[model samples]
Every structure is written in C-alpha cells, then in structure tokens.
Target: MESNSSPSSSPIPIFSTFTSPFEGSSKKSDLTKKPLSLWPGMYHSPVTLALWETRSNIFERLLDPPLDAPPQTELITKTPSRSRMTIMYNFSTDYLLREQYRDPWNEVRIGKLLEDLDALAGTISVKHCSDDDSTTRPLYLVTASVDKMVLKKPISVDVDLNIVGAVTWVGRSSIEIQLDVTQPATADATDSVALTANFIFVARDYKTGKAAPVNRLIPETEREKSLYEAAETRNQLRKRKFKDEKKELDNGEVDKFEELLAEGRIFCDMPALADRDSILLRDTRLENSLICQPQQRNIHGRIFGGFLMHRAFELAFSTAYTFAGMMPSFLEVDHVDFLRPVDVGNFLRFKSCVLYTECENPDHPLIHVEVVAHVTRPEFRSSEVSNRFYFTFTVRPEAKAMNNGRRIRKVVPATEEEAHRIVERMDADSL
Candidate 1:
C-alpha cells in the first residue's frame, strides 16, 4: 500500500447487515449487520490501489472486505487524527480463492479495514511516542479468528482458491483484534467463498501508556467490549504451552537451540546502562555511537538518496533488533537530510540507543532508536544526524526453531518507514 498521506476525517462506507433466507444461506449479502460508517476517507484512493495491484502475493493484501452491517446514515463533523494501526497478513492463493476468490476483493486487504476500525474507537495513538515527556502510547491489538470449515481445507496451488489473513490490529496500541476465515454456503465449484472478520479496539493514553478506563460499559449491549473480552480470552488460550514430557533434545539440538535462544532473548529483555558497556553506552551527550557515512554517489556515479536511507534504517535497526533478540517490526521514520555525497560500495555502520521507551505500554515496549551512517574507506569516517532519523520496535516471542529449548523472545518494529524506504515493502508477515 502507498504511504497513507495523513489521518483525515473523510467518510468511507461498508455494508455490514444481512437478511437470512431460511436462516441458512451464506453470502456477503446475507451478513447479519451492515458496516457502521461510510466515510470516503476510510477507503484507499484509486492511485494507491492501482500501484499495489502491480505486486505479487501483495495484491491479496489490498483486497476490499465485504460489510453486512447497516451503514451509518448520519454524518458527523468530528473526524479523528491518524493512529499507528499496522497489520501483517500471510496466505496461500488457493486458500484465499476458496474463501474469497469470487468475492471480488482478495489477498491482504486489511489496511483499510483497520483504518476504519480506528475511526470507530474514538481517539487513538498511531505513533509510538509523543515528544512531550518521551512517553509511549498503546495501539489496539487485532487477531483474526477463522471458522473451522475453512481451516480444514487450506487451498493449494492450481486450485485457484486460498486463505490469507493476520491476527492484525490497526488502532490504538492498547486495543486488541482478531479475524477468522469461514466456508462458502455450498461446497460447489461455482460458489464463491465468503470472507468476513471481527474487530475489537479501545482508546488509550498517548502518554503513561495505560488503558484509559472505560467511561461507559453497558453489560447488556453486545458492542466492542464483549468482542474484546472474548478475543482476549482466546488469545490467552492460543498462547498456552504444554510441557513436553518425553520431548527431550537430542545431543547437538540442545546446544544449537541454546545459541539461538541466547541471541534471540536480547530482543525481548535488554538491560539499560550508561557507561559504554556492550549493550548500552553513552558517548558525549548523544547517548550511543553512530556511523555516519558520507552521502553516497551511485555505482553509475549518480547520488541515490533512496539507497542511503534504506541502508541507514537497516543497519540501525539491525543493532537494536540484535539487542532485542527477535526480528523487530519497523515502526515510524522521520524524513532524512542528505548533506553531502559519498561513492558506491563505501562501507557504512550505524550507531544508536534505546532512547526512552513508549512509557505507556510496558507489555508492548517501544524502543526509540536513531541512526547516523558513516562512510568508512580505509581512510575516513564521520558521524552526524544529517543522515539521522528514528525507528520504533516492539518486543515479541521467537519461533520454536529459532528459540531452541529456551523461551526465545525478540523485537519487531511495526512500520516499514522505520526500516525500509518503500511503503509497500513486505511486513513481518511476508518476512
């Protein structure tokens, strides 16, 4: 998806309500409820969608979702600002086509769904931190829970049908969400598989990162709170681990898992210090060391600002993630300033720090990292913010293969801007 320009209050519409014929027929038109709003700003502009259509597997990520709920006919003047609601979805084409192939919108069409969700939750935070006190904010958490019918039959290639999704959240960092895939009405080849998902989000403090208490919770009303509580329970259930009674590691497997486990654990629980110890050291008033490379002049001899930015983000986050353990999610990135130019193949290294974290969310920790790339020939090196910018990362658990026997943890930044220059770069899901 193209970088969203800014959070706007424009209206976008979706259909969410459904009428049942014998209360058994399944179709987008049979949805029990219609979408709550129809704000144009909620939908992606034609230019953005057109650009994404050119990519592979990515086309599935931008599909439009079907709404069955009643559209909110009333127009309100209050539109909200943008929040950092990022989602990552992974899928196979046959599975997606089997479920939503004939539905029109296909693949990873989650960005817009998340954007609209943020609008419904009132004021939410998108950026990890605010300049005020250097505190972090909570973004809503989302998880998609697909029904069993689709889970039983994962679509494979040449089948023309597949299922693609993510346990994605695109609202306040504190809010949680889930999505599920379901089967079509009939098991016929012509029947288009129906696809829909549920969203649960909450508003949170921009600073002191806590869940702002619910001012109004109606027990009888089956609104967001009910869905949130249920999703939270389900999430907890999914996270449960059963001890392996007879699954002992064979000779070298234990040692290999230990090595990766130790490396990956840094991303989850890194300690802080001031003196130049390996992990956290302060140099001058800057906090940590950085390698600022001279501006790069391309291989063909032309200066490429793009290549420099990519390298800067990659090297900088590499250190932060290495310290955190897991592959970090790329969060946010400020614009860069290219002061001078350096030649191609000039070695560059980035120096950085674990600046004040997003104070609000202790669970979903946000590390503010900065980078200054320096050009290192056998002769010289310089350091400056002219090539400097910030990146955000959130710590998460590592995969079993990478974790070994120990509980492995790592960090993931949420935005491409924090690591990659391209807005359309594959997210953690693709990685």
Candidate 2:
C-alpha cells in the first residue's frame, strides 16, 4: 500500500476532550485554570493520519511474504536491516500550534511528537518479528519502554521533521529500536538533532498470548556495534530496576519517606527553603479519563501506545501549565514504561502531578511531571496501573519575567518514600 499522495490542506478537529476529571461543587479559581487553547493535533489531523498511513504501509511490507515466495512456505524470512524505516513530515505552523500562540513549538506540540515516535516504534517492533508468515496466527507487539530520550533542542514548526528507526538489539521476545529525530539544515540554522530515544518492544502471539521469538539483530558496522552495546547496558539497568521493584513489593516496604527522614534529610518545615517548597503534590496534580475508541486501536486491535502517550502528555502539560502559571517548553521525556497492553474499549484514567521543581533564578525554572495511566473494567470498576511516564519542561525566560519571576511551585512529598523517589528521579534527570 502506498501513502496518501496529497494530504488535506484544511485543519482537522481535535477529538480529545480536555476537561478536569475531578468532580466538585466549586469551580477552580482562575489562577489554577487550564489554558483553554491547549489542544493536540495528532488525534484528528489529516497530515498526522497520512504520516501514520505511510508508516502502516511500511509495516505491511515488512510483514507480508514476498509474492515470489513458495506457497507452501510457512514462515516469511527477512533480514533485520530490511526492517529499518524512516518517515518525514512537513508540519505547518497551523497544523501543530494553537492559533493563540506565536511560536509553533510548545509542551503540547512536543506531546504530539512523542505520540508519533511511539507509533513508529511500535510499527518497527512488528516488522522485526514478521518472520512468522502464518496469516491466521498474527504477532502482536506493544511498547515495553521508552528510555534515554534526549531532547537536544526545541522543534520549531518552520523545519520539517526527519525520523529514523532501526533495530539495535533483539531478545527472545523483546527488541530495541533506536529512534533519531532531526531536521534538514535551513538558511537560518544548520541541520540539528532534535531528539533521540530508545524504545523497547515485546512480541506476543495473538492467539496464544505468549511471548514470541524474533530474528536476532546482527551488527555489521562500528556504529551499529556501539548502539548494540548501549542497548545491552540499558537492558541490564531495566532488569535491575525491575528486580528492585519486585523486592520492594515482596518485603512490603511501601514507604521510603521515613527512611529518608531518619537519614537526616529534612523533607519539610525548613524556613531556609524557597517559598515554592511549601506546595503540596496535590496542589499541582490533574486527572483526565476517557474510554478507548476503536479508531485508536493499532493493527492488533489494542490501544495504540502513541495515542496513550499523546493523552498522557496533554495531562502533564496541563499540570505544568497550571503550576507554573505559563506555558512550559518541553525539555525531555526521561522515560515511559508500559507495564501492560491496554485493550480496546477499556476505560483509561490519567493522573499527572508535579513531582519536583528546581529554580536557580527567576528567569528559568525546571519542572518535572509524572503521569500514571490506569486501565479499568467498566463492569468491575477495578483498575490496574498500566503505564508510567516522566517528563521535564522549562519555563521560557520571557514567560517567567513577564509573570514577575513567579517561582515554580515545588512538590512537597507527603511521606518519606515519596521524598526518596523524588530524589532518585532528580538524580536520573541529571544523568
């Protein structure tokens, strides 16, 4: 299948409902109001759909057996290098930004970028495992994690985005795809790397719902060797983290707050601390819930990871905007862990909060936002946490100065465990 020859020129309607999930008798004051114009374009934009369609075509080619292949062959075999894919999109200012904003790039637009990345990564995963030629027994792939995302600079609307994804490592069922986002050199600026991220995906048999094997990734070039080695290191770190989490659960060690406090770390009631330190986690939190629709499903009949990322980003942006009292520029997406796949028609609840904030000067403030996604069954009303996303943003100096150097509110952890988690995240961000 070929991608759309011409993308529609008209603007598309936003499909998401940007509203507070919390129910209350009293309305939030203007000081905490969400920006009315904070809208995402990926869900309904024709250009976005066209780009995704092109990606889908690539995926189809990767999975489909060659026409000349023997009819009796049960498995379709292809080299890993043949699975590599690249996509480029020319986004107009109107396509990405709200009409109220002068600049096209902002936290909301960054969310859209992340959404596209997730989609592309998921497609690559399916391609990597397409050796199975059984049409009736399809393979399903879901995003396992997104890590080591480095945002070199803010993406402007004036430049077209170039996204490249290639397989770097493959496990029995999991594969790592390194994605690089760049823009062509322009008259005003040289070609630059906008973002780089490593996305992990796991393949499963659609019928049995069990782990499926994928072709190994053989590195031939020196650059490929380095990427493969880096992926190995990251995989080790993920294992250690998972083991530690399991141990914590087994030991029933729920709170680490008291442990930090006992170690002479002052979590609260310090007058020397900045005024922003007094802000509670609840003060800068926001929640949004929606039912998954069929349109949001991928080829496997499950919710697309990119769609979930887009929704999560919007909530995080809202939380940061409400706390900072201004639009924030997206700096980095520290990590996103997808614990499990979400099925279509499941109700998803997104809870986002300002985890921490650092302000050295009134000119620039860094805000760390955490978002947790939960999937609930409509009948039982029981929910399981499905994903966790960490993002960093900075308030522009001009925006901060205009607000009279408004101090970005800090997250006040209610317990020692929460404090320790905050510190760990802070350290991770530094790396």
Candidate 3:
C-alpha cells in the first residue's frame, strides 16, 4: 500500500455523535431547578448538570471503559492491521487564538494538537486490540512515551486538519501508533504534511492492573511493512538508550566533565556576550503552580496527559519568548516522558528554564526549553516529579536583527554536574 493510501474506501465511522439523554423532554420546570454544587460555592442549573453528566458519559463511552471498572463491550469491529483503524479531525475557529491568526508564528497551539494526537493514538490502540471476544474484558491503555515530533509547517487557523492514526507495531503488552497530520489539497493547492508523531501505549488489565497482551499487527502492505520496520528501529533505539543511561549512572564510565570541557572550548572562541549586557538562563526561567481542576480530569478521573503537556508547552514557550525577546516558532517537541499519573485536586507546579541556546550567527538562533512537572500535596507540602518535556524553537530573524544584532542569551550552568549533564544531553540529541 502507498504511504498516503486511505485505510479504507468506505466511511470508517470512527466517531459517534452523542444524543443527550434529556434531549426531548418537557422539562422546562426541571431545567430551571438548581442542582447541587460541584464544589464549594459552585452551583449549576439542572440544564447544565444534565449536559455535563451526559457529556461525561458520552465521552467515557466513546473512549474506553472507566479505569478499574468492569469491562464493557465495544460497538466497533476489530481489525488486525493498521489499515482498519483511522481517525480524522477537522479544525474550527474555536481551536484558534483570537487576533493571532495573521501572525505566522502564532498559529494553532501545538499543545492542543498534541492533545488530539494523544486521543487519536489511544483510540487506534483500543481498536487494534478489540476483537469479538476480547471486548468482554476492558483493556486500559496509557501513553508511555511520545517519540520525537517534527512539525514541517505551521498549522494555520483557516485550513482543516487531517489527522490519521494507525497501529504500526505491537509488543506483548505495548503498541506503537503512528499519526500523521496533513491538510487535504484543494483546487488552489496540493496536500501538505504538517506534522508526524509516534506514540507508544501499554495495555493493562482493568481488574488486575497488570500488563496485558495486545494483538499483533500483521503487515500485509508495503506501507505497513515500512511503518512496522520504523517502529522496530525506534524500539531498539529506546532500549539501547535506556541501557546506556543505566550504565552511565551505575559505572560513570564516560567522563561527562571532559566532554563539557571540549565543547566549551569550541564556544569560547565565539564572540562573548560580555560586550553587551546579555541575559542568563536564570533571567528566562519561569515557575508556575496551579491546582488541577476537575474539568481537566480524564475519563479515568486522573489529570489528562494532554492537559499537562499543554501546560508544560505554554511555560516552555513563555521561557523561549522571554529569552529571545521575540516570538519563537515552535520547531519540534523532543521526547516527552510521562513518569507517573497525576490525580485531580493536586497542586501541579511547572518549572521551566532555558537549557541551551546558540546565537553566534545572530540570524539563526536556536533555543531549547525544558519544563518539569511536579505534583504536590498541599496538605503535606510534599511534591514528586511527574513528567519532563523538552522543546525546541527558533526566533524570528527580523526580530533578532532589530535588537542591535545582539546574540541570544546563553545558559550558564552553576554546578559542574549540571554543566556536564546538559552538554551530554545536547550532544546526545545532536546524534
């Protein structure tokens, strides 16, 4: 099969419209009745109460069975390969930021797009595992990792978004889903690739909470074979990286300090920022904390992964903008690791800092921002790291030229360990 071939010629009916349970009822009096408060001092009308409940139920039913709950049968038929599972979403004005449409750099929020990708990948995983008898037991899936995501073009507000997700590879308990974002060609132009991503999800038995087996993906077409092979290559890389990280931590065989010293020599010869009152990493650092609200909860009643990712991205973007003193175009999101699940009502704290920057050319400056999420229990004043996100952005050339041709700020590591680690990670990413 061709890479761009449609999964099927017929309509896949991947999405289902929900009919509100209270759709056609002579409930004018009931609608006016006030419902109990969802929280302290937060009451809602009966109409809102009904709608919220119905919406939540519809989302849960459409997605997957509630976590730790009894298994429920799915309505859709199952397929073995990626060809049968496909999902597409159309973008609307609601997805765009007001007054930012004209700005080339300020297009659709990458956070929002990532959220949709996560949802679609999860949906595809479920469909791949679902079969006639398997539906009797619920299989819970969670995103373990999002591989490097590259954005080829900025997603404008007016164009419709075409997202397609399919199972590329599967393991004993994990499945890899490949998602491609594109804009369909119109009479005026041709289709363009916007972004591509690979997500790995692990299945768990709802009752036992143990790793569960997923159906194997049988690659019948050339496209499927290619995707499968790519997934395998990535899987191997992940394993190797993990092993190397463990080895480094255990033995410290590689001298990161020496590596940093070598790299520092290369940058030392470049123009120093001391000539101009330059910015430092501390100057661009930002910290934000907020309580996770119920609205951000997923069907499983835990904080949504996409919500966390969006928050992290926003913080990273702010850091990049502040350091660059210009609007930065998002280039790509590096590997995002979801360490643990966060519960609702927890205080989530985000700390963002400029990890690396290079502006020797002045015309083309690169900025790398890192955001780490921490979940805290306010009562105990205790916090645990939840996730880490790395992002890359490039500043507008014109803006860089406007600031007296000043060089972008450099991140000076205060501690030798930190300097070594940062340099090591940067070098690894380059490889």
Candidate 4:
C-alpha cells in the first residue's frame, strides 16, 4: 500500500502481488504498480471485462460469497494506507491498449474511464473491508454514488496513465474512496495530473443481503486526516441536498425562475428573437434504451455500476456534441446517484438533455448535461428512475471553428418544473 501517506501496518498479501490482465510482453510490477494491457488472449474483450476477471476472486469469497473470512483476522482498526493501491494503463507503449480506450477523435474515452474508476473503487472498498486472511470478505460492496470527478488536463489516449485509490472514510456500512488519475513524467514534461474522483461504496452481508459493518478507518497522517474530514463534510452536504429537494421552493427562488421562463417565452413569441441562438431545453434532448447484458454484470448478477455510468456518459457527451455543434471535451462529473441496481434482462432507458449552458467565452461554451436512467417494466407497471447523472463538457478548441449548425449560445427551460431542476441541480462549489 502506497500513497502520499504512510504504509499500512499490515497490508493484504494478495493485493501486494495483484496485476492487471496484461500477460503478453509485459513484466509485472509490485502491487503498487500493476500495469494494465488490453490483450491477454481476450483480444477484443471490453477493457473492464478483462480487469473484472483479475479482481473476481475477491467477490467470490464474499456472498457470490461463501462469507467466512477468517473471523480471527477481524481487526479493531484499519488505516487508509491499508487499502491504497495503483494500477497503470500502459497505453504510451501499447498500441493495442490505446485502441480500447480511444474514441473516434483519438482521445481517451470518458465512458471507459468511468468504468475503470468504478472497478478500481470496488477493489479498494473490498481491500479496506477485508479481514485479509481469507479469499476476500464476509461483506459485498456496491457503488452508492460518485461525488465528483474533474479532469485537470486533457488526457492523451497514447500516454501511460496511473490510477491510485484509497479509503478516505468509513461508517458502519459505508466507505468513501478517492482516486487520482495522472500521467507519469516524460522527457519533455513533468508528471501531470489528469483527473481526480471520489466515490462512495456501501457494504452488505453476503448471506442476508443486509447492511454490514466494515472496518474502522483511523487516519494515520495529516493528509489522510484531511481527506477523512472532507469526506464527512461532503456526506453531510449530500444528505442535506436530498432533504432540501423534498421542500417547496421559496418565494425568491420561484421568482427568479419565473423571470427566466418569461424570457424564453418572449424569445419564442417575438419573431425578431428567433435566431437559433437559444434552444428550448426540449429541443436539445436525445434518448437511447437497451437491455442490460449479462456480460456487463458484476459478480452479484446485477449490471455493474460502472457499466451503467459508461452508457450514461456517452449519451451525455452526445447530447452536448449535438447541442454545441462541435466535438465536446469532458470537463467534470458533477454528481451521480445510484437509486437502484439494474439486473440482467431488465430494459434500461437513458434520457439525456442539455440542462444548461454557460457561453461566457464565445469560442468555448461550457455545457451542463443531465442523464436519467429508468428501469422500465411493463408487466410490473413501473418505470422508475434507477440512476441520475450530471456531467459538464465544453466544445473542443480545434472544433470551435467547425460549426455543425447555428452556434448554441443558450439553453432555456420551457416549463417551471424543468426550471426547478436546472437551478436545484447546480453545485455551488463548482460554480
């Protein structure tokens, strides 16, 4: 276990020797530096599918999970370093590896990155909760939500990438993990930080499917202490926001939205304002639906949380691209909520919309997009929201001059309810 903090007092032996699925022409490093490659006989396997196999044994031990981690190994306290780990995507030298993560524009696919983060976070959670003397655990972990992920710089698909994650905080049945994505220093440039992400995972008993207690995480250093504190603050904010949504909007908030709604109506009623500069939110919508595939399922037999995020991100990217009339670059993932799990064979529908746009810089507009996932079941007569995702993107610099149609300068809500969502979903810290 390695990070900016101290090493774990007792690190898990298996994680200390874990390696990614790259078995060809690849030399494995210590657990701290597991270099990943796309080829290990599964030539065209989804990068995540192969990586999943590498970490599958951890799941099998828990409730998919025969549950009996050596009861004797259970400790009273665990530190952040105990779960710290890093993996590498050696795309800088592996052409085959780069192909799996690259998009049409030869840039790293944000969707794939989302999947990687989820997979890595899951492993970290397991590492933290593991008793460490058995196959893996007595508890199963699942992603609860992604607090945030922001790109510090544009990630190159052909560069080697390092993903490091560790446990930041833990409650009886919940764990907060933070991940940093960076590029190793090269001859021409110093080490570069590409992205940072925070994810929350909840633990459950394999046998009973009930919330299960995890190890106590005692911060061992100043950095770890700060991270631990921040996670607590963020958790409080999330709970507050959830409660706020159930309350009625105050007079001032309602007035402000009404004014914006009036402006959109004026733009529609007045012929002189129709320049296609502003788009009705409804006009920027795009949708897609698919049956949850078993190949994308996690060890628990439900569609992997990361796979769901992978699909939602691509849809959000498309919404931004079509709305902006240019290629879009991912900026940040503001927030996400996993309301429920989608099982294999379930019909999942993704609805994406251009929630809002900030065109302060005419050449590069910042677009906010929202994606809602619904588990639609006709026989059960329910089409409930299974997930909600919010993402931020901007027009690529080179593509700014390449307009697909009229420039999209604004996105205006056509209804009061839609107006409420736009205002409430905003994260003030990001602003």
Candidate 5:
C-alpha cells in the first residue's frame, strides 16, 4: 500500500476535566471525567515497557507528521528538521504473564500503553526512573495492525514495521487516533509485509468516570506530517480493496473447497445431546489434498498464522459440533505451523478428521483432529498443504443443558503412528 497523508492531523492541547477534591472549584468544563489515578505497580516493567515503545515509536513516527505542515521549500532554503525522540529506556518481556504468549489480545497491548500514558500524564510514576517531572501529560493513542502467520518450527518471520499514528481532531470526550503500519522487507527479502489501521481513545478521569477534553496542540513536525500522509494512502487502498473483494465474492467463484472435497473424506454425523462432539469426527480425506496459496496473491497479501488457525478451528468446530449437538469446549490447540502462505483468489482446501482416543477413561476420551489447508493458482494448479494443527476435544456426558443432547462416539480412527503418538502425548499431559 502507498504511504500517504490523512486529513485528521490537527492536535489539541490538554485541559482539566474534573474539580480537584482538595480544591472545590466545581466549574464543569467540557471535560467529561477525572484524570486516571496514580497507582503503584501499574507502570512496572514488561507491560509498561512494551507500552512505552509501542506508544512512543507510534507517536513519533505517525502523529508528529500529519499534525504539522511541511516547511515551505525554497530554491536556497534547506529542508526542515523532523520531530524525533530516542529510546530513553527499554524493558524486558519477563513481567508479562507467560500464558499471554499463547493467546495475545489487542486490548492487553492497549492497557499497557495506557499505563505508560498514565505515568507520562503525571497520574503515575515508573518505579526506577530518575526523571520524576510531574507536569507533562502527552496526548496520543497507540495500536498495531497484526497480520500474523503460524510458522513451522525453528524458522521465524519477523514483522518489520513502520508505524504512523497521529492525534486526530481533539474533542470534549476524546481524541481520535489514526495509525498506519508498514512492514518493511529485509535486506535479503523481496517483498514487504504490512497492514495499516486507525484508533480513537477518549481520555477519561477515573474519579467521575467521564470524558476529558484534549486541548493540547501538537507542534508542526515533519515526522507527524509524513505519518499522516502514510495513513491516508493506506486508508484509500483499504477502501479500493473492499470494493474489489465484494466483486470477487459476488461472482460465486468459490473454487477451493469444492474441488478438495471431491478427493477428501466427508463426515455428517449427529448423536444425542452429548456436549463433546470432537471424538466422532474421523474424516481426514482433505489432509492429503490441502494446498497453501502464496502470499503474493492472498487478498490481504500477508499470511497470518493466527488467522489461518482461526479458520482451522472454525472448520473443526463446525464439523464436530454438527455431530455432537453441543457447544464443544476448546480443550487444547497445539502444534500449529504455517507451512506456506495462502494467497487471495487461490483455491484453498481444508480437511479435518479424528485421530484416535482411549476408552479406558470413558468420560473424557481424548480426540485428536488434524487439519491441512493449501492453495492452488490458475497457472500452477499444484496444491500444497500450507497450514497444520492438532486439536484435542473431550465429551461432557453430564451436560444436560446442551441443546443437542448428549452425543456418543460412533466411530474411531484406524490405528496409525501419528494416531498412537497423539494418544500417548495426551496420556502424559494428564499426569
């Protein structure tokens, strides 16, 4: 996507939204809520550190550019300086809970950013920082446009990013935040991995639970203007993309699934109201025929491991729940890999089937499911499986609340090396 300027670049200044409890001057301005409280432990390492980098970098790279106009160029005049800030401190990721690495959320990242903002706003303090000036409350919001992909072991795909965020029009309730993320290619890389987005955060005072006005005017800075332009360009591209995708969907060109199903095993089984339906889905024909579309052609043009897993999980759930007649609990999802990139318009196929289970523990019979999704282009119809995951599900026989009633296992996977290995691992994990 081309980097261009966005219209929402003006920055406002800060003003009070609440009457101090110590001073009873209760003239309510347009400010809606009390400033957030200064709390201990809120701005500690890891979370706070990530927040600091995310916010500071995003602000300097994104906001500063759009808010300020570029210096007028003259034949003899030199170009103007850009707004810039060096890294003052870096925090390790140790403070973040290990479980967070498994299921990361956008809100979690935002919370950390806000915590750092609270410290910068004079509502809080970093424990070890020497600079304790309590008067500076910086204005801006931070966000990420994540296009994640599941990868095979040992290899890593770094998300090289150029972030652009600016304080949009400030208001009584909030300041609109617009951001654009550009993932750059490395020295040896041939293509860019990127996504752009925008966010708006309303400043709130913790005491009154209301909105606060942003009156802080951002000084004109070259960095801010450049970032804003980038955002505008990204926005326009996104709009054009939506139109194109709509056209593709309307054409009824569902190419991948129908072809793969021809060569794959299909299952349509339903048992009485058993809550766990995973054990009965023993159809695995699509695994051998799956293929991954390359990144160049995918609509987003980026292969996100998480997005691929989500699709796999959705298909697994759809197949399993249809047979078991209950909401299946997501017991575990392990061994996810992005074997390849699935591009847009490429024919993609997915296959899911139960592996095996031990009847020794009757209530929770471990169910193993395998998935393979791949892509095939028009020129080269050679399909390759690009994604894989092993999912485990158990039956909840006691759940009468299940709408579909208790489901009982009707079939099991034929014993195989992978099947035996899965059961053995499940047995060990239970210990």
Candidate 6:
C-alpha cells in the first residue's frame, strides 16, 4: 500500500478527476461541485484525504511541458515485451475497505477499478508508441473502445492485486492492450484470476492531428502470438460490424423488429398472457446528467474514457437496483463502444434501463442493463451518443425474498427504438 507521504517526483494524478487542482480562482463555474438534495452510498473514503494531499503536487507537475508533440521519424519495429507492464497493490499488508477503493458494501468498487485499468492502459499505449529513449510522454493517445470485461471471480480489497498487461496487436494508428487481474498464491490458497480486459487506443499526431503509425509489434512467446492473433480477429469483427451497420435497410432487420414489436404489443395489451411476471422497459429506466469537468479530462484534454465508464457503471447499477428492488451484485461488463470524444463543458447525459432479464431462478434473477451517454448541446439543439455501456448484475435470493418475493420483471420493448436496442445487444453477443 502507498503511504500518505508524497513521492519526490510526480506520480500520476490519480484523484484529479474528483477535485479541481489546476484552477486558481474561486469563481463558480458550471463544472464546480454544488449542493444536492441527497447523496447516495458511503461517499466518504480515505481516498479523499489522499486526493487533497496530492492536489498541490499534481498541479505542480501539470506545469511541466506535456511533450505531446514528437517529430515524425522513420518507422521502427519493436517487440511487445518492450511495452509490457505489471502493477500491483499490496493491500494484504495493511488495508481497510474505508481506506482504499470500496462502496457501501465491503466489496471492491468496480467503477474505481475500471478507472485504474484505463489509466494503466493509457500508459501502456504511450510506452508502445514512443520511439524516444527518454521517458517523457510523446504521442497523443485516446481510448477507442473496450472489447469486454468479465469478472470471473470476486475481487477482495484485502488481497494483493496484480494487473499484468502488454501490447497485443497494432495497426497504422490503433493498438490493443490486454490486461489481466489476479492474486498471487497465498499460504492458504493457490493463485486466483479475477478478470481480463482489452482496451483499444488510437494514436494521433499532435501537430497534424492525423493517424500516427505505431511501431510494429513482434510477439516474443507463444502466448504473445496467440494473443496477437486473437486481437486481430477482434479487430476484424469490429470492422465488419461497422460495415453491417451502414448497409441499406434490409428485410431481415425489419422483419425481426416487427416480430419484437408485435410480441411487445401483445404483452402490453394482455399482461395476464405472459408466462412470467414482467414490466415495461421504460418503467425500468433511470437517468442523470452532469457538466463535464476539466478535472476529468485526459492527457488529450478530452473527457477521460474511464471517467465515462465509472459514471455509466454507477447509473447501470442503480437501474438494476430499481428494477430488482434489492441490492445487486455486479457480474460483468460486456462489450462497449466509445463512439466519440466528449469535450469539457459539454452537457453529458447518462440514460440507463434494464434491457432484459433471466428469471430461470426466481430468487436470483439475472439483469442485463444498458447505459447510453449523450453529449447534448441545447444551444445548438444537438444531442449525439458518445458512448454505450452494458452491465450484468444479479440479486441474492434472500434479498429478493425481502422484496416481498417479487421475481425480476422481464423487460418488454414497446417501441421500435427499444426493439432496435435489444436486437443490438443480441447481435453484440455473436460478435
């Protein structure tokens, strides 16, 4: 565990997203935090104190040259091992849920972990693209999308956590980084793997603002070769999916949507005819909006993708909680898309709803939630989707029983838009 004392050199600005560190004046801006009627969960954590202590140090570091611009040079091929990185948290030595990343429950807050993963991936992408011998960051990098993140095992805050990653694949401008989280073998138990995540980052020239070719990746080991191949396949699928979305209106999609609309209409008109209890998809919806803050900006000065993920995950959890009417345990985060970058001062709106549910087990129903983030400019009368998030959660049987034994209500799409969203999820699974 990191002590309260600050490092001599600047460490990463880990908590700058929550508190304003660079702004000097006290003038109230739209980005400033304001009073709210109600705040949820255990918001007070020791991390706040850490953030306060590091704010000044982080600001001083921000004064240094960003070095984002690098002179264009001849291409050079590099091995993936050159960019490999492994970061670990020694929480088992001295730790408490309130001292580190945790929520109302004693379990780890997945939202915070997602932020850490993004930071790590960003660092790796920088390392992979840099040709200079010095450690100064050079290339402009931004997260493109995330393939998938599945939690195979529950992560406990008290255990020493290890995050291992390396460059898996590369293109003219984009690079794929694979990160795996695990716990080392303990005296009592063997090593336990928790989750794996893949982050795609696109490299851009700071001056030309064009796609910057990265150093070619050469796999050193069999495992590395396998990973490279897998990433290539994933990339191919992404391209194909994008092409499919651009095709002209086909009968296949139209006919499928008609069936969904018809089924939804019948269920809405005759509720008693449903095989199991259900609810309208709109009823399971929840939303909140925020003014994008400069503190949350990435190195490129745009809103951080990880920050967006954190907000989207929280909204998705709330949607599932309302639908289940009980506290839910997070299962996994499936595929997600970062369609566009969100700029500072943008009115960011997050809309979430229960997309579907599995009630095979009445007590512990599986809930799939979707969250869509839009950057709305009321001044220009423009609202465009910037990202899409998908999350899965389930409630404990005992907790469900406490809700008067109300089984999870299956989500029925009543509108064409809703039907389209549901089909998108179904298609994403195959991808």
After superposition, the stretches of candidate 4 with alpha carbons farther than 4 Å from their true spots are 1-57, 67-75, 133-137, 185-191, 266-275, 404-406, 427-431
lDDT per residue (tens digit) for residues 137-245 in model 5: 2222211122121111111122212233434323343333433323345565544433222333344332233443334334345665665455456446545844763
For all predicted structures, in order, the TM-scores are 0.28, 0.75, 0.76, 0.84, 0.33, 0.79
Model 2 whole-model lDDT (C-alpha atoms): 0.65
Best by lDDT: 4
* Tens digits of per-residue lDDT for model 2, 63-138: 3424344322244444335556666554443343332212445322666677767776776666666554543444
Off by over 4 Å in 2: 1-80, 92-108, 132-136, 185-191, 246-277
Query: lDDT by residue for model 6 over 1-431, one digit each (tens)?
Result: 11112232223322222333434556665246432111121122223223223332332222242556345476677767766766656666644432457577766788978876787777677767766533333556789989789887667776667776778899999999998877655555464668899999998766566788888888867788898899999999889888888565468767767877777887778878864676778878899999988667754678878788989999998888877779998988987778989988999999999988878877667889999999999999999999989998998777866878876776778998899887777666545
Better of 1 and 6 by lDDT: 6
lDDT of each: 0.33, 0.65, 0.65, 0.74, 0.36, 0.72
Candidate 5 differs from the real structure by a C-alpha RMSD in angstroms, to one decimal, of 19.8
Strongest candidate by TM-score: 4
Model 2 TM-score, 2 decimals: 0.75
lDDT of 2 at 299: 52
Tens-place lDDT per residue, model 3, 1-431, is 13334434122221112332344557885475332223221112222233233233233343354454445443343233433333433334423222322244546667766766776676567667665342366576788999989877667755555666678888888888887877665554465777889889998876677888777667777777888888899999998988777444322424645544444444455536332433344556799999988777655566767778878888898888888778788998988878888887888999998887767666777888889999988789788999989899997777766776656766655456656556665766687
Model 4, residue 180: displacement in angstroms? 0.2
Which of 2 and 4 is the better model by lDDT? 4
User: Model 4 reaches what TM-score against the true structure?
Assistant: 0.84
Name the 10 consecutive residues with the lowest summed lDDT in model 2.
1-10
Instruction: Summing lDDT over every window of 10 consecutive residues in candidate 6, give the lowest-scoring window.
Output: 35-44
What residue runs in model 6 are displaced by over 4 Å at the alpha carbon?
Answer: 1-70, 96-98, 133-137, 184-191, 246-256, 266-276, 361-364, 401-405
- In candidate 4, position 147 carries an lDDT of 80
Error of model 1, residue 53, in angstroms: 18
Candidate 4, residues 1-431: lDDT per residue as tens digits?
Answer: 24544443222111111344443434444243333332121112344444444554554454245555423245458878777876777777777677778799787888888887887788788778777556544676789889878877778887777788899999878999998888766555574777889999998777677887888999988889998999999989888987876787678777868866876786668847754677788888999999977666666777888888989999999998887777788988877878998888899999999888887777667899999999999899989999989898987766866554346567777787888777776534344
